[model samples]
Target: MSTTSLGASAPSRAGADGTGAATGPLRARRRWSGARLAPYLFVLPALALFAAFRLYPIGWSFVLSLYHTDGMAQTWAGLDNYQRLVDDPLFWKALGNTALILVVQVPVMLALALGLSVALNSALLRWKPVFRLGFFLPVVTGLVTYGLLMGALLNQDSGAVNWLLQLVGLPEVHWLGEPFWARISIVLALTWHYTGYNAVIYLARLQGIPAEHYEAAAVDGAGPWRRFWHVTLPGLRPALVLTVVLSTIGTLQLFDEPFIMTGGGPDNATTTIGVYLYQTGFRYFDFGYASAIGYALVLIIAVFGIVQVKFAKEED
Candidate 1:
């Protein structure tokens, strides 16, 4: 009887140990799942903020574009606003002005920036830090301040630019008064403000280029221009593409300079798509039309972005 009782008690103890061994892995798996979730939990706040601010506003803007609102009553307008935009001569003029800037200003600014980056990166250049700071200063300055300064400097009569022109036996230019001059002034201001920023980008890319490539080119009897064309140009292609796309987008959304400097005036010669959108929305109180213009601008940006990407891929 005693031996039988001992055998039954040993079996019961073995069963209890087996049950604990099985539960141990289950608890560990639960802990591991919680640990794996920590990173996503940490990112939740930023995701929420982005959704609230950026994504929500974009969605609401699209919805608003489909409805006509007069700050009082609202009605569904569907594509009427878009049709109005097509017929609106001012919209076309604005688009033309923006295209002109994109074609003329972007290339000039980027070329100048590339040149400045090369100069700054050269070993022969002195006071490199000072040059960089001086060039970058304009980028850090407030847009409104820069606009006011530009306006004062380019004033028709007492402005410093005209004063210097007269001193040099040249006629005073109507920098802000005439249509052609107004457009030119806008381009000049944009170039001055953004050139340094683009140069910094190019400078960073320049620094990353391998010195061995240039040395090898020098050994092969390649002149400076040939080396640049073969080695440097290939290296800078990615940066060039990036800057071009950015400049295109910026040129399409040009508003601050034209608004502050010319008020889209001088016969609307400097009016851009962004300026037109603002005018339609606030000045004319055509919210739906403005939203439509905004979407059109977005569409233009998307199409250009896609084309740029495709071109880059082909080049690659």
Candidate 2:
């Protein structure tokens, strides 16, 4: 009887221990569920704001594009506004100007940025932080302020730029007054303002590159230029792709510089799509047509963005 009672007590104790172990984990899991939900709850407000402000505005713009409006009256116009866009010569001119800037300025800016970044990353360079800050300062400056400064500097007669040209025995060319020079000035201003921003991005990416890769290249007797071509260039592919796409989008949306400096012409030479869109919607009071132009710009950006992403993936 003693032996049987002892065996029975042992089984009872084991059963109690097993039940407690399982219950403890089950309670812990319940607590974890609440913890996991807390992150989602924290993000809910931000998601709601994005949906209301960004997503809703985009959807409403599309809807508004399908209707003719004069601010006081609205009527369903279907595809008429898009058709008008097709026939508008000014629209094409603006698009061409935007395309020209994108083609010419983006590559030049990115190239300069890459070169500056590489130079800054070199061990030979000193005062790196100061140089980086000085280069990036223009990006933080107000766009209108930059535009005003550019306009004053590039003025045809009494401008500092003309004074320098005359000092160097070069003829003083019309900077903002002539069509060709106006376009060139816009490109120069854009490059000055944004190159440092791209350079900073490249610098950040360059820092993440492993030291071992460069050491390995050196072991194989690769010189600076060779290593840069083979390793640094390949490593910077992702940054290059990002900067190119961003530059493309920015150039297409060119406005403030042209509007504030050239006022869209000596002969509409610098009139970008953004300036034209503003003139159409606000100046001409053609809200429906303006919405159509906005959508067209969106399409252009989407197409270019997709192409850039695909090109980058293929290179990878």
Candidate 3:
């Protein structure tokens, strides 16, 4: 009886050991798999949120563009919305005004930014911090707040700008009233807001440039103008390209200032594509046409961006 019992216990112990040996690798593999998948599991929620909020809306807007939405019912419109865009005078006017800004405001603002960056970076400049802060202060202001402030200042009656002009024996110009002067006010306001932001961008790029390049240029008997042309300009090419694309995009999408300051007013002189899109969708409940406008704006931005990048590369 004792011998049989000993023999039975030894087999049970052997079976238990064999089972642990086989399961150990499987358990280890499961642990390693969990470790490998941990990062993806952690990031899954963020990816989901992005798809739900950002990607889904963009995709839906494109789908919505193909239908006529009149705030009550969505009717199948095919490409009629796009066809309407071709014949729309207000759309053309908005496009023309946008083109004017791209041609005028963007170049002028970028030039001012470049100059401000150079001046601020120079050793001869005193009170660098003060100047830098002053120049960059506008960029920190909220869009709505700045727009209201500018609206107040550019008011035809009882405005500080007109008051100053009156003091100087100049006529109180109708800034936001007349079409020509209204456009001028927009250009000025845009320049005032974005120049410093671009300057800061340029300043950061300027800091990234090596001092050795400047020194080498100087040692090679390159004057300030020559050095600037050969070294500084070349060094700044990347920043210039960046600013061009960004400023173009920003100028194209100008809604707030024009909306708040001019109300796209004085015969739609200041109406940009962005403002037009807003007026179409929200004000008139023409969602389909507005979506088409949005897509058109996107296409225009893409074309200009590609062209600008290619031109910048060709310069290299």
Total clashing pairs for each candidate? 0, 0, 0
Q: Pick the candidate with the highest TM-score.
A: 3
Ranking, TM-score, top scorer first: 3, 1, 2
Candidate 1, which segments miss by more than 4 Å at Cα? 1-22
Q: Lowest summed lDDT over 10 consecutive residues: which window, candidate 3? A: 56-65
Give the clash count for model 3. Answer: 0
lDDT of 2: 0.94
Tens-digit lDDT string for candidate 2 (94-155): 99999998889998999999999999998999999999999999999999999999999999
- TM-scores, each model vs. reference: 0.92, 0.86, 0.93
Candidate 1, residue 96: Cα displacement in angstroms equals 0.5
Candidate 3: TM-score? 0.93
lDDT of each: 0.93, 0.94, 0.93
TM-score of 1: 0.92
Report the lDDT tens digits of candidate 1 across residue range 1-316: 9999999999899999999999999999999999999999999999999999999988888888888988867799999888888899999999999999889999999999999999999999999999999999999999999998898889998899999999999999999999999999999999999999999999999999999999999999999999889988899999999999999998999999999999998899999999999998899888888889999999999999999989998998
